[model samples]
Target: MKKTKTRLAAIAAVALSAVLACGVLAGCASDKGEQKASEQPEQTAAASLEGKSLNIYCGAGMTKPFQEIADAFKAQTGCEMNITFANAAQIQTQINTTQEGDFFIAGSADELKPVSDYVATSTDLVKHIPVLVVPADNPKGIQTVSDLVKCDTLLLGDPESTPIGKIAVKAMTDAGVMEQVKQSGSITTSTTAPQIAEALAKGEGDAAIVWKENAGKDGLTILENSGMEGYVKTVPSAELTCAADADAVKAFSEFLQSETAKNIWTKFGYELV
Candidate 1:
């Protein structure tokens, strides 16, 4: 009878060990399930706007930085962006005619005036500064706004179509030399900043007033204190009334002011407001 009791005791011990082992395995499974559940919310949030798309009207000068921002936004939310780039006036006309864009990003706040009634909300993103750029080696010896009269050919943006053109006129006018600058040289009008930069790079013009960021192009030198101070324009991004997806537009609008977007703008030579 004692031998039989010893065997029974050994069996009972094995059974207890098996039960504890099973309990430990079950606890591990529970922990894993909780971890997976905790991660779901983040995944869901990242893909909340998946399969959605937005139409954006952007200024031509902002193409580089805004393109990178749009790519980053697409990666985070899996949404697609259709960007239309042109001079501010052209973009304003497109927005009014189409009546179908999610956001409007302009070189200046003034560009948004015609579309103000269509803008649901707006935010200032950066500074649009105009600077005088000349070809390398200062071929014309132009050193100041007053010296612009020396150039046989001077490129200026069209005040009716470009923010830089308006700012250039105002800067020269503010310094009391607009008429002389015009009379001393042939004032050639461009429709966009890149066009002015391109014209300068090819030696098509002696000097041009363009956005400060455009001065980064090759074969150009920005002249300091050429009388453009205090004529800075504010770059503004606005959500339009024609936004097809409000949530997606809101998400992108918020992203425009994020640190990531600011870094891109700075990388492209833009100054944050």
Candidate 2:
């Protein structure tokens, strides 16, 4: 009986040893695959929908060109992204009270700082704003600021709360005719900056104070004529508040004024500051 028990014990030990050997080999194979993966060159992660989401508060008109660029960022960066567009005043107001977004593109740098009211982190990124435009035909015979005001055409800009509207109102006031003109009922207000030109082109209004970039297109007369260019200033920032995704915001912000964006900007009649 003792001899028989020893033989059985030897068989059990060999089986256990064989199982341990197979487990060790399997672990080594997995480790090799992990090491190989780590050794490979890292891939650039362009902006992606499945990655991190970046919120942008900026001019709605920028949506098209911005998306075109963001599409490429996705192909490369793998970061998620989203944008919330609004007029200058609306954005500033929201930034002051509401939770801020990852980035802020102000029409003027002067307008961007309010983001700090809620969020402590912010950075100015780019600058741009409206330049007056008229019809290609120069209907009502508009030429310069003075001529623009004299005509029976509509003067365009956001309403009073908007920075550009305030600037435009102030400019017209400085030129000595803000109230007189408003009193005369000669002007009409639009929501977004782009609407200035759209209103003119669509014949909803006559002349408009549009962004320079929004001018230069077909069927529009650029009334951003020399010397009367004192209507506004441009400013923007990539950082604002406690942005949840700072990296992606910084990346896209850097591209806002990039040559590529500038080209599209100029195409729209906006001049670089």
List TM-scores for all candidates, in order: 0.86, 0.72
Instruction: Score candidate 1 by TM-score against the native.
Output: 0.86
lDDT tens digits, residue span 78-123, model 2: 6666767778677777766667577776666666555546444444
Pairs in clash, predicted candidate 1: none
Model 1, residue 133: C-alpha shift (Å)? 1.1
Point out where model 1 deviates above 4 Å.
1-36
Clashes of each: 0, 29
Candidate lDDT (C-alpha), each: 0.89, 0.64
lDDT (Cα, 0-100) at 241 in candidate 2: 56
Best by TM-score: 1
